[model samples]
Target: MRFLPSVQFIEQSRVADEFVAPAAVLANRLLDAKGLGGLPPCSVSYFIEELHRPGAAIGLHSKGRANVRLNLAWLAKLAQQETAPEWEVAFVILHEYAHFVLELLEAREVSPGATRRRIEAGHADFLRRMSHLGWLADPVSRKLLSNHNAIAEEWYCDAFAYWVAGTLPEPHAEFFYELLAGVRFPPTS
Candidate 1:
């Protein structure tokens, strides 16, 4: 995968470090170990500044391809603190990569009209299932039912992170684990 140009900001008192390298390696290791090899090549770029988006999202992935942009400000904070868990950075990278993989899967679909609707409905169905599994109050899952494409993409990414890390403290994490229980290894085309 080709990495695009990235911008970094570090206080003059602190030394800049290669955080991206280790994060990428960890993300790749999880993807390979999980047998999710169908995803196309992708790149991740890091920045110490806030993204131009309106909310406080820590990362962003391109919708149609395997590319990610991470918030280095958050990463650097985690790097400097001893209390920060090792899986934090890796989870962020893996989640973004999952978004790429899902989008690649969607784009590769060659079926006609109803197929697209069916795929979206499948994702929505999963979200609805989560509600029944005790995730009814989760904001993300609630959005999932109405915001098909983007919310489903986020759900898939979060599920990938949960799968890699083995646990998530979030209220809706159980929903992801339940989904994982039924998925076939290496994933079908």
Candidate 2:
């Protein structure tokens, strides 16, 4: 439950006024959040640049256990005009931390079907849409199905986010549940 090197983006100028302190506090708290003790040591990489496009992923969990990066560029923008900007930053960070923990706990060979079922149950609304799509156009669905390795990880990560911030204000949970409902990565056909 130790933090790695600090996540400093020298180019940061926007969220400097608001986000960084809370981000650091939340990251340190998460390292020992009890439920997330099994999670890997995730170091945040704050960047001053924009993501590939508009509304891209604000934070990403990658390279298994080493890195979890968050973009300060967007955060700064939100900070300038938004009330309680740090709370939003904290929420998204916990989401990425969820991804980190899932990667730490993942078995190398979890079957795609079993993994999908587990995730679907956890995210019940997606389960219904997926099941409906599975039934209505079985052939097309079979044709369209692709391995869900990364997506399954994302689902578990989403649940972890839910668990991590279960005590946060209601908007975070509502937004998270909405995100969870349409959670498929490649988009269901």
Candidate 3:
């Protein structure tokens, strides 16, 4: 995707100012690869570490911008596994991006009833649209849906992450499969 000049790239370390910390360059690269590299001014705010947790997590608000908390220990663990922790980081960004898309498309109608209606009414169309965009090729497994809220917006974000990863710089079938393997839904045609 082409990046416009309106985007601003904020380094995590700069936010902390007076401390030596783990670098978030990989995380930055992942967001860039996913086409959300630069945020528009207050559109996004990133913090290097968290006051409580020690892993990559995000605290979101009703509005667009969010505080992304990246934990060093969690990233180191993810790095030692295989692909960079960026995939998960990318997912974090897309999770918020999904919120943005939903708000834009739905005109701020994000209530539970409205969301479920949208998901159900647009179910086929949603999958088809995502599939046409090459998002549905990844099958959601039964293990995950078993424990997750089937009608939740979080599911949409998870599905979007899989789709973005496929089309972005890292096409990770294995990691995605692992993510989907936890799906609790039964397979369907």
Top candidate on TM-score is 1
What ranges in model 3 sit over 4 Å off? 1-56, 62-67, 80-83, 108-116, 120-146, 149-151, 166-189
User: What tens digits encode model 2's per-residue C-alpha lDDT throughout 39-111?
Assistant: 4565656555544442233445566565545555555455445365555666566666665444433444255
Residue-level lDDT for 47 in candidate 3: 49
**Whole-model lDDT for model 1 versus the true structure?**
0.52
Per-model TM against the reference:
0.57, 0.53, 0.43
Steric collisions counted per model? 0, 0, 13
Candidate 2, after superposition: displacement of residue 17 in Å? 9.5
List the global CA lDDT of all models: 0.52, 0.47, 0.42
Candidate 1 lDDT by residue in tens digits, 1-189: 222222323442122235556666776666655555445545766555655432122344454456566655555555555553346666767777765555454555565443335435646666566657674445544443454335555656665676665554353445444433323256333
Measured by TM-score, how close is model 3 to the native structure? 0.43
Instruction: Flag the better candidate by TM-score, 1 or 2.
Output: 1
Best by lDDT: 1
Q: Which stretch of 10 consecutive residues in model 3 shows the poorest summed lDDT?
A: 1-10
Q: Which ten residues in a row have the lowest lDDT in candidate 1?
A: 1-10
lDDT, model 3, position 109: 53
Off by more than 4 A, model 1: 1-17, 50-65, 112-123, 135-150, 164-189
